[model samples]
Target: MPELDAEKLKENALTSIRLGIEDFQRSKLEKDQGGDPARALSAVRNLFAGILLLFKYKIAVSVDATGDASVLIFNPPEVLPQADGKGGIEWKPVGKFKRTTIDVATIKKRFEGFGIDVDWPTIDKLQECRNHLEHLHPANTLGEVADFVAELFPVLREFILTQLNEQPADLLDTAWPVMLAHHEFFRDTIAECQASWAAAGVPEMMQPWLESCQCEECGSSLLRPSQQDIEEGASVDNQDNTFKYVCVACGHSDLIAPLMIKELNDAYYDDPRDGGEADVEECNECKRSTFLISEQHCLWCGAELDYPTCTFCEEPLRQEDQFNGGLCGYHLHAYEKAMRDD
Candidate 1:
């Protein structure tokens, strides 16, 4: 077995960490003016590499009985201990060549064994985004890049400070301030946007989509309902029904109804042609596929629908089952049977 120096591995880990932070800082600084996509991509890739390297460093430093350092290497060769002639033992590798280093999965399992409280979901998210950006060009947006950093900051900060016994601010240096500033800005913006949505007085059914709403044109989620839109939404009987929201990021105006219809329908329904029950259906009055059966209202035309009954048998109908010639599914089936018999 080749003698591996623990100090060299540690140095490599530290270098990767510093370079990762520097890349991340560059990405954050250029975020406002539609920053370079390459910076964000590099930031994620370097940070992921740094994290894996740190994990490997931790594993490499752990002491073993034979001092063979086989545990640090993936698919490590079995070693046989023999007498070294002078009341000593020597361990030899089973294979002729050195094995590859442990991978991310192994690192995670080993961390769990060592009782490390790392937030692995955050790590996985970073890895996923990194792969997406590096392999698939322009896969993630700047907002997504900021989101990845914001979610990962606390995990990285905790691990570096508690596990590595190092001051993050000192290690990260210039990147530390940039990370903190970006996190605060990202958090406050989300809070403000959510607050504005809450005050918009959208219906209870539409609240979930409001939080995740994005501008279709620019894909920016920084949309806010106008004051007039809020007032109309609050009013119980506002016939005007013209609610508007503007994407602050893109300066684009869109009607809230169409956006809500698209989002809500996508969230709740699928094509009936695909053999799935459609949660939303076409509105009889508006001829638009914006009818929410649960709400019993056309989201686009404001047409309130009553629970449908079969015209022939007067039986209650399932909300999702479309009425065929004013007949429930049971009656429709019976009519079909009778026609076939005749």
Candidate 2:
């Protein structure tokens, strides 16, 4: 194995420090101390730079470890040896080349090869923030900029520490207590209810989106499907082909079709299908399976579909375009009213 290049690591590490110190000072002196919205642009850019630098450091380490010209840089496959001579192929370097410059996409692809996922949403948000701030982000105040900056540090820190085998104390240790306090502040606000969930027996997977499934009146957890609707035949499993979630605390009921439910009479073993991805088209309004392609109407809600417009109201329906389905709320009500009067 080639010896790890201390010189290469040192160069990147030093650059990360130089950029980080300046980034920290701008956030503190300009944004925090002066409270200048004018400084918000520079401050946010600094935060982005620092975060990217940390990521760059991790990438440098990966390059040193493999030393494969093809794998690390843009060198050809002939320069890279294929077999590890064991069970797997290794990216072994046979020929030498100068280090290639890397950008965000390059670094992202590198980590992905190690089975690490890039958080595209977070990255997209920051890039958008940067673009907008240069053109103008909607939130330009010191606090607004600071909040955006604060949110990203923890995410980057976690990634660096987890994947790079580095400690915050050895890296950005000074920011540790601040991040801890930031968590605590949020715990007292948005996360307070979440902390108590484990004691209340709430599943962890559901915690992130718990607000969406909460009872509007009583604030009770409602992630589990309602047995009441099932037993009452309001949403019978086979007949209605729907799933219902009823709030136990306030009796608020919501129904969604098991539009994803599939039945295969024969040859399911030979030919497979994904019910959720293949056949299901959720409604834009209620987020349900009422978007049946053939029916052109939501049977449960009587919503007017995209295929047919309401004659009286002339309301346009919105549907998953590929499914070519839609429903107009106004016409459905009008038709139901006219039927009742008759």
Candidate 3:
């Protein structure tokens, strides 16, 4: 008799997204520390659930009966007769999301009809990853293919904004502390991955090394042998096996012996019940990655620890150690260089 409540569902949708972010941040920490990638799969499952809630919201606010019909299919119409025996039977609605054949296929087609451009190929791949995470033993390869999660955030956020006509900043504010922190982590993680690929310089030769090695500095499994014949930006200092590796996540390049590298790999992948946070300090501001207390700041978010003097951001150095310049490994060095050059 009464109409569906859109406001309440929207509130729930936002909350789900926040919860999903929390799960993802925690699991990501585990993966970065050379722990089991399987731990991160649970985060994927939870995030997908949050995404499904948004789909429900989209369907709930349809422009016409087409929307109701779409929902009606899932919420099957139950045949109910009037009080009088002679009265004809009328259709009663079932629960939400009960319509016939409700799935990725149905949702995609419906979104397309509304001129919403959802990325089907990426979504398709993610679904497969999610299935494996849910049903089979989690693999490092499975984690590798999950790059789509970072790509999907903007798209889904846009869908909610465009359909609901809500302001981005307002949704952002609603998302709050976690939203900003997650955004930073997602952005930095992707950038770190990209930099590693670029730094790989000799990919063809290093493929085997990458396949066998893991980068403890970045907790990345994409470690591979570096191209030894690079230009003499500087002469090799202690060139032994030339078996150095570059981590896509941390950009740490070292000329370690092959046997030493293998030992490091074992140490990195060793399973831990507490995600290896026992020795590392979680960021005080963002609470993302766990770093050594000696660092005095989180390597991921630049959040100060100990004294909390928090000068990391106030003085954004154009260069800090190997990092481009910024705090906690965050940097805008390239942009600053361009400004100076101009």
Lowest summed lDDT across 10 adjacent residues in model 2 is found at 259-268
Indicate the residue-level lDDT of 306 in model 2: 38
CA displacement after TM-score superposition, residue 105 of candidate 2 (Å): 1.6
Per the 3 Å backbone cut-off, how many clashing residue pairs does candidate 1 have? 0
Rank by TM-score, descending? 1, 3, 2
Q: Look at candidate 2 and give me any clashing residue pairs.
A: 132-136, 132-137, 304-327, 304-328, 305-326, 305-327, 306-326
Tell me the spans in candidate 1 whose CA falls farther than 4 Å from its real position.
1-14, 25-37, 61-102, 135-140, 214-223, 226-332, 335-342
The candidate that wins on lDDT is 1
lDDT of each: 0.67, 0.48, 0.51
Query: Model 2: per-residue lDDT, tens digit, 129-177?
Result: 6665576432323333544544565676677678766776565555555
User: Per the 3 Å backbone cut-off, how many clashing residue pairs does candidate 2 have?
Assistant: 7
Which residue window of length 10 is worst by lDDT in model 1? 232-241
Model 3 over residues 1-342: C-alpha lDDT tens digits?
Answer: 224555555677677766655555554555566555454566677666666656756766665554464452253445554454566655554444542434677677677776766667767766776775566444443333234356456666676677767765677454445555545666776556445445434223223333444444433444434555244322222243354656554456775344343443343443477555333433445443333344455433455533322135543221123243233333355566668999
Decreasing lDDT order of the candidates: 1, 3, 2
